[model samples]
Target chain A: MDVRVDRDRCIGAGMCALTAPEIFDQDEDEGLVVLLNTRPPQERRAAVRIAAGACPAAVITLTEQDTSTAP
Target chain B: MQHEPSLTEPVTLPTQRAAGCPFDPPAGLAELREQRPLTRMTYPDGHVGWLATGYPAVRAILGDPRFSSRYELLHYPFPGGPEGPLPPAPVGDMTGMDAPEHTRYRRLLMGKFTVRRMRQLTDRVEEITAEHLDALEHRGPGADLVKAFARPIPALVICELLGVPYADRDRFQGHADTIMSMDAPPEEGYAAMAALQEYMAHLVAAKRADPSDDLLGDLACDSDLTDEELIGIGAFLLAAGLDTTANMIAHGTFALLTNPAQAEALRTDPDLAPRAVEELMRYLTVAPTTVRSALEDVEVEGQMIKAGESVTISLEAANRDRERFPDPDVLDLHRKATGHLGFGHGIHQCLGQQLARVELMVALPALLGRFPTLRLDVPADEVPLRTNMNIYGVHRLPVTWDED
Candidate 1:
């Protein structure tokens, strides 16, 4: 899965970081989302999905890719 | 604006919960949600507006920018309330302001309440929670948990964060109470708000003259925000952070007391604290209702909400929506209750949410652990409820524990 976060849209409520600390972190200064792993492995998908869904700002977006078909 | 013949008679907002069911949303609101999730309502000023009760409707209204948060555009939802359009939100009260304006104030404050920052404050929250628990034990056999424990932990934490002297809690807390009290006369609430702003102005000036290492002090030193803005921000943060968390602690305790099985589950397993807090927040939903005005005409759930009309979103009712939460009325600690509107949604979501979570995660479990046999000192029905306040909670939870 591919993950992306929009810092401009983030209100820094920190749901993403709290929900999926491995995939996302808030910048120490502004607390806006900081994407830790843009392409998290399959094991981390559930947490990522929860984090995205739980975000109040809806700042996190995820794209699913077929790993077997990829080069 | 064309209204359907069926929409001629509008339902007034329901304020009273059913007897003996203190934890649930008002029965009338639940019935309304069941019948029509989104319906027209008559405001105090005779303005016809919308009332949203379903979880999806509330979430969609809050998330949509077509709906404005501007205070001036809103029609007061309650009966016999203030008439005409309300005044514009005060300079730093982001709750009543829209983006660009709200964005500036929110951005400056966001960094202070990040997940990492709140985590850093956990040790201090734990210390504060422990200290309050100690006090409760020292004075116990029985005590009003609201005063003796719940109110002080968050009050002190917010004071420390803002560099406000803890000794002055009574002064600011009184002002905050008046501001939050729905029963307070409009003039009195205004006077209390003015007094608080005046106090914050002085604090900001002090912070500007001799900067300290705290939220207000940092803003005073670094930010280019004006004095009025700083004062507004300071008072807003205090009023926002103080009672909301205090009430949550009190109400969560009351809920747990009433539901012994859930309390036991939390007390026995330390790991359940996080999920327990979320469930409690969803169940209790202290800061219940919020209003938003439509900036332009919008269609929601196939209903046309005309421009300039307001919609009162019932966070409490939404949290209890059966579509979103199965057996929504039950307080199940094991339930995964994320995405609840307990702290609300969208850009204007609760700024201090992470901090509130830290305080709750620390305080609630510790309270249950400290007093295993804790239960209400009075009959559950006899405990006073803060029904008249903008935030809902027990006015004073008289709780007791078996002597060790």
Candidate 2:
């Protein structure tokens, strides 16, 4: 899955960083979101999804990977 | 269209918080919530709406996009003879707006409130907290905590944020206080509202002419937001940031004094102050209720709420729901009070929350630490509650401490 934070829309509620700290970190200066790992491992998907859903500014967007031809 | 008064008769809004236990939601409301979470409610304006009193319903309704938040859409339920929704919240007041328009403003202003910025703000908030504590100390034992400390901390923080000239604070803060109040006369409130708008217009213009490092100045030069929009946004933010946090500090202190066990916990751990703030928010539920209109036909829990119908969510009742929190009335600083809607929920949840949280975490503990003997000057019941106003708090919290 592709993950991203729209720095423009991020309110820095820190819900994303708090929920999935490994993949999502907040910038110290502005407190805007910092995406540490865009495609985190599958085991971490639930926390990532919850983080995106919980963002007040709704900045996090996750796009599903097209795996139609996966071996 | 009365529908023959199902289950129980329509209950009014602003039900008195039970006499002795001023913190609890009105006993009548708890009974109503128990009978059925949702029920028909009539507004002062003669409009009938749905009132959601349960935890699940209140929380869900706030987050659900199907509910409209536009100011004019929902009928105000407060006792002041429900008039039109406060003359259409100025152009950029996102609280009255829905998607797209709200999205625009929220996106533009979100960066300024990031947790990183707010935490880094710890130094500034601490400085402000210390200044107020010093003023309180110098003034000695008896002081209206509300006036001397609680109100000024957030008021000054907001003023500095917008770069409002220090000279203009006396005039603007008075106008703002009148405007935010639920008890102010219509004539006075409207006049103050207009004056505040004019003052903000001039301030915004000044920022445009000479942009400074402040939020308003940065917004002036950075965004394509119009002057009027900027003025509206400035007032919106100022009003939002000031009263909410101020009331929390004053009321939270009162709560801690009355519930010394919780205060003692904070005194011992100090680290518990952050969690204590959230617990206080949930326990007090300061901004008790909110209005939203259903944009389309929808069935919530079993009832079919038709389009254009308004719903008043009783946040106080919801926060105190026993299902959500065991012994909901108790003020336990250690309770993991996450998911509480004190800062509200969903798309329109408070934008200034991080700032408010930081202020509470700083002010509450510092005040407690500064004066270990801090206690109320008057009988607990005589603290002069701000029941008439929209924001719930003490009009004047008279408190004193033993001199060292």
Candidate 3:
């Protein structure tokens, strides 16, 4: 699965980090969010999905790879 | 441009739920908006008054100088007042003053609340949130988020911010909650204020004797501020800084968890937290109402508001206004246009907004990242709303995260 964040859409509320710290960190200055990794390894898929769901801005997009599509 | 109060069969104002108190008016304020966008209701003090529920009317009342934020001591409309008897003043006192004087008092302590200053506390906020989450394991099932999580984290932050000893946090946190409650007995509210004031007096004295590198210490060393002013500012900071954010952290979390999609979104994309928190603030609208009084007789939307009439600005109403937001009822975290009165508007807007924002931005994301499987024990609707208070929040939020 791949996750993407529209940086400009971030309002710096930090829900993403609360949701998925492995994927996100707040920039020290300006409080803009940074994506540590857009395409995290396989084991991390669930965490990525949770982070995307918790996003208030709806800016986080989770794209499922073929094998990951089975619910 | 103001619209006339929608003149339909009168429905209750949301604040009326508390037996005619101004605290939680009526629910269909949306209806009132169609009726009279700007209109008067009875004040607890037995005076007729204006209530501004529309987005423009609310913002105008809040940001414009025609209205003042100084009715804190008056006997105008509504319920409680300083007129009955002197209540014990809380941690600080500038909350009762207006503009120039209010501005002057705020300026003395303003140096400490800047975004830059709050950044210094972000790491500590994260640490505190994590520590609390860790402690939840010991709390086991059905721990109250209000007591265990929400109350303590901000209590500690405000304590450390003002240089108060951590051991004294409980007294002040309790006092802060009491003071923030709209339904609190007048005597009880006074006592909370008194407790806070006495607490700040001692802290201020200690700071004077041996100043530290904290906000209280900075105020202590300032030559221009009198001891009285410093004490007043302390009380203001304590009540203003602590209780509001405490409610926000609590309610914001409750808002997210109830909306599983929202919570799930956070779990997957921690980077979206900052924006999510903003959306939470917009949706939760925790600080529901702000009161202001007309400084001068003015006409808005063809309704004449006489000077000194108290006007309540509905933050939730304003945020939900159809004019400012599309699909106002739906939660859209990614909405491009993002100016809401969640923190209030204008000069008297929350001085601690930046600090509160930082705390949420850091704390909320960190919380979800650490507890991936967390889910609420009770249905979201079953969660009790904060009882009869202007500050809306859940009484308790119980959730279980996956063990291991």
Best by lDDT: 1
RMSD of 3: 10.9
Model 1 C-alpha lDDT per residue in residues B272-327, reported as the tens digit of each score: 98898889999999999999999989999989999999999999999999999999
For candidate 1, give the lDDT of residue A1: 78
TM-score of chain B of each: 0.97, 0.96, 0.88
For candidate 3, give the lDDT of residue B38.
73
Q: Could you give the C-alpha RMSD of every candidate to the true structure, in order shown?
A: 2.6, 4.1, 10.9
lDDT of 3 by residue, B178-236 (tens): 87777787678778877877887888888899999887887788547767767767777
Instruction: Estimate the TM-score for candidate 1.
Output: 0.97
Weakest 10 consecutive residues, lDDT, candidate 2 chain B? Answer: B81-90
Candidate 2 lDDT tens digits, B1-404: 56655685666664777677868876778877787888888787777778999888887788778988897787878777347554556687898888878878877787788666777789998999999899889888999999999998998888887787756777788887887787776778878877888889988989999999999999999999999999989888887777899999999999999988788789878789777877998998888878899999978878888998889988888888899989998889999676677877777878888788889999999999999999999999888988777778888999999999
lDDT of 1 at B361: 90
Alpha carbon lDDT of each predicted model: 0.90, 0.83, 0.68
Top model by DockQ, which number? Answer: 1
- Which runs of model 2 end up more than 4 angstroms from their true locations? A1-12, A18-23, A26-71, B1-9, B84-86
How well does model 2 score by local distance difference test?
A: 0.83
1 against 3, candidate with superior DockQ: 1
